[model samples]
Target: MQPSGTPSRRVSAFDIALALGGLLFIFLSAQNAGPAIAALRADGVQGTFTAQRLDCVEHPGHEQCSWVGDFRSDDAAVVREGIGFYGSERSTFTPGATSPAFDTGRLGHVYGPGGSNEWVIIAALLLVGLALTLRPLLRLRRPPRTPAPPPVPEHLP
Candidate 1:
């Protein structure tokens, strides 16, 4: 509270730290966006065909969904069990049965925080962090909107 009866405002250290953390993702995503996109578009053949929908058994702390099938291509040979992560929506494979390959080529796999979608998610986080950070700063700068005191009427003689 101020002497003028209005509340004072300041951006807290905790808020600043959180904002910085969130904003960092944006920069990080930008750094990875180019490479992730390129790898996804590169000459990769569908690694799995005649695929089967593999869901992790009802277990906590597991992703629980992916495709498992054999890898077949001119560059590769011999049927091998392959599993894909976080690609359920793109998969056409059904549980316990084989299906045509949904992917045209093998995926260019990256270690972590890779793929175009992850970039989008990071960007969203950055924007949210920016908003969270900026809101308090803006409030501090804005003048308090307290109403003016009413004028007193003069007494009649």
Candidate 2:
């Protein structure tokens, strides 16, 4: 607790660090959110992804997989090579097979026709960041209390 008569709580290095970290998280969320939202809405260049191969990585208990492919827009205006199809699974596509996809200018990956839940994670990050940033400042807004008066002594024995 702060001593009486102090105007406000002193800000600490930890508080500053927390706020900075929160800002970093907020910045990261903002940076990725646009592309993620666009991809989730399929609001970009409509294209077809031709699967060239399946790239799989084995973890301790499971395997993560994606289809590496080339994308060509329906209008033939946009074409991307060596891009991975987002949310692809092991059996999602066969070699040389094509699937409808959307390119929202996110590096290295294109979204599929079925939308993704990526925005949920980004929203959560943003909320947590806001909370962290505000928690330290909230203490400073509270008014300080005056010291209480001493109790009177007994008058009679």
Task: Name the candidate that leads on lDDT.
Answer: 2
Best by TM-score, which number? 2
So what's the TM-score on candidate 2?
A: 0.85
Residues 44-138, candidate 1, lDDT per residue (tens digit)?
A: 34333445556555577744555555554435653445645334433435665543332322242211112235545655756776676576677
| CA RMSD (A), model 2 | 3.3
User: Candidate 2: lDDT of 112?
Assistant: 91
Model 1 lDDT, residue 14, Cα:
79
Q: After superposition, how far is residue 143 of candidate 1 from its true place, in Å?
A: 2.9
Overall lDDT per candidate, in order of appearance: 0.53, 0.89
**Model 2 Cα lDDT, one tens digit per residue, 32-90:** 99988997787989989999999999999999999999999999999999999999998
Worst 10 residues of 1 by lDDT: 105-114
